[model samples]
Target: MRHVVKEKSLEDEEEESLNRQRLTSARREALSLYRDILRATRFFMWPDSRGVLWRDVLRENARREFEEARFEKDPEAVTRLLIGGRDAVESALEKLAEKQRHQIQKERGDGR
Candidate 1:
């Protein structure tokens, strides 16, 4: 009886740890995706000054994408979409960061 109890306790601990890891990863991914979306929108609308107009359109499209992906009900597909979206967003942000860095360097050169 004591051995069985110990085994169950260990199993419970392992499950808890796995759940915690999953939650932490999900939170990190969510933040990354959110940041990417914001950065991408800014990059798109900045020079042309269409931020306000584009925001509404982007929001609608984003909602539809989420709903469609969720409705698919396939774990693999869900994971792929979430990861793909995050990667795409991260890529956009990286591009924006590089552009900003270049612009800063140009300004410094002109100031010299």
Candidate 2:
């Protein structure tokens, strides 16, 4: 038996598709930022597993900014989201440097 979808359900599905498309478009601007965030998080996961605080903060800020842009319907907020996401990713990268420092110190101690 072939199942038929209700008209209302089809309409809802279309609306959901549109919403997803819009979200994808907005996120395209921040894709690089997201990748950077991931790289930073991975970098910070070494040695003593430190820098969790800043990494979490950057992640939260990036999430908040993206949500604001996705739902605010304001052009300015959308722009801010793109910029803020990039900045947050950079902040995460800076934290990664601290992780690198900790790793270096640990290696030096072991050598000594």
Candidate 3:
């Protein structure tokens, strides 16, 4: 019984350690995604007044989404959220790039 209890305690410690590592990794990924989204928002085209509004909206939405998932304990759920956020950031970046490209082409009279 003593030996069995010791083995179970060791196993529990290992599981706790793994959970901590996973949480740390998830936190880092979440922060990275938050930064990337804010960076991408800067590239969005808009007048000064509307630009501020857009930035605020984007930031608030991102903050709310992360906050809503702040208590997530499942590693799989965190992974899925990270993947989805990454895809969203990539899509936004691509859209920004395409918009800028078109703007430049139009200015050069090549978009006519």
lDDT of 2: 0.66
Query: Model 1 segments beyond 4 Å from truth?
Result: 1-58, 110-112
Q: What lDDT score is found at residue 111 in candidate 3?
A: 100
- What Cα-based lDDT does every candidate model obtain? 0.66, 0.66, 0.86
| lDDT tens per residue, model 1, 57-78 | 6556666776665445344565
Q: Is candidate 1 or candidate 3 better by TM-score?
A: 3
As for model 2, its CA RMSD to the true structure in angstroms is 9.9
Q: TM-score of the candidate numbered 2? A: 0.45
State the lDDT of candidate 3 residue by residue for 8-108, as single tens digits: 58889999899899899899999999899888787654645555666667778999999999999889999999999999989888887888899999999
Backbone clash total for model 3 is: 0
Report the number of clashing residue pairs per model.
Answer: 0, 0, 0
Return the TM-score for each candidate structure. Answer: 0.52, 0.45, 0.82
**Model 3 residue 95 lDDT?**
82
* Worst ten in a row by lDDT for model 1: 43-52
